[model samples]
Structures are given as C-alpha cells and as structure tokens.
Target: MVLVEDALLLAASAFIVTSFVGLFRVVRGPTMPDRVIAINVVGSNVVIVIALLAAAVGEPGALDIALVYALLNFLLSVAISKFTVERGGVL
Candidate 1:
C-alpha cells in the first residue's frame, strides 16, 4: 500500500511538471488554435493529476470534483474553439 501511494504521488508530480511545460506553448504558440490546443492539453493534465491524487488518498468525493473539472475543461475548449472560428482563426 505504501509503494502504491508513493507511485501515485510520483505520477501526479510528473503530470504537474509536464503541465507547467505545456504552459510555454500557451504563451508562445504562433497561432490561436495552437494556443487553444496547448490549453486543452494542460487542462487534461490537471484532470489526470486530480484523479491520481484522489486515488492515492482514497477520497471518492475528490473523484466527483475531478469529473466535474474534466467536463468544464471540455466545455472551455469547445467555447474557445468556437470563438476562434468566429474571429476567422483557422481550426
């Protein structure tokens, strides 16, 4: 049990680090679509991290929060994509 918890924490930490790296693309992407995609990727990484932490801590309530966050992330991506398209940005 201790080993499993440690592994989960390590994996969550890795995802958090990679998400920070992905933020660079959000800042420096040459196109709106590229930035939106990077944002989506970061959001996904966050969702995974939340889920992993929830599992590690044995909190089912946190899983519900993670699921809600994942849904919000999807909606945000869709909304941004629509906005960009309306503004003449290519998909």
Candidate 2:
C-alpha cells in the first residue's frame, strides 16, 4: 500500500511537469488551435493529477471533483474551439 501511494505521488509529479510544459506551449503557441491544444493538454494533466491525489489520499470526494473538472475542461475546450472558428481564428 505504501508502494502504491508512492507510485501515485510520482505519477502525479510527472503529470504536473507535463502540465508546465503545456503551459509553455499555451504561452508561446503561434496559432489559436495550438494554444487550445495546449490548454487541453494542461487540463487533462490536471485531471490526472487530481485523480492520482484522490487515490493516494483515499478521498472519494476528490475523485468526484476530478470527474466534474474533466467535464468542465471538455466543455471549455469545445466552447473555445467554436468561438475561435466563429471569430475566424482571431483568438
């Protein structure tokens, strides 16, 4: 059980690092779609980290929060994509 918790922590750390990389992309992306993709990547990484934390801490509520966060992320991505398209990529 200790090993499992340790592994989850490590995985979460990796995901956080990945999210930082995605953050850089979001900041430096040359195009709107690229920034959107970066945002999705970061959001998914955040969800993964939250799920891992829930497992590591034995918190059921965190899992539920993570699920809700995932849904919001998806919806936000879709909305941004639609807005960008409608705006003719001005975003």
**Lowest lDDT block of 10, candidate 2:** 82-91
Per-residue lDDT of candidate 2, residues 1-91 (tens digit)? 9999999999999999999999999999999999999999999999999999999999989998999999999999999999999999964
TM-score of 1: 0.97
Candidate 1 regions with alpha-carbon error over 4 angstroms: none
lDDT of 1 by residue, 1-91 (tens): 9999999999999999999988999999999988999999999999999999999999989999899999999999999999998989894
lDDT values of the candidates? 0.95, 0.96
Per-model TM values vs. the true structure:
0.97, 0.96
Q: Between which residue pairs do clashes occur in model 1?
A: none
Whose lDDT is greatest here?
Answer: 2
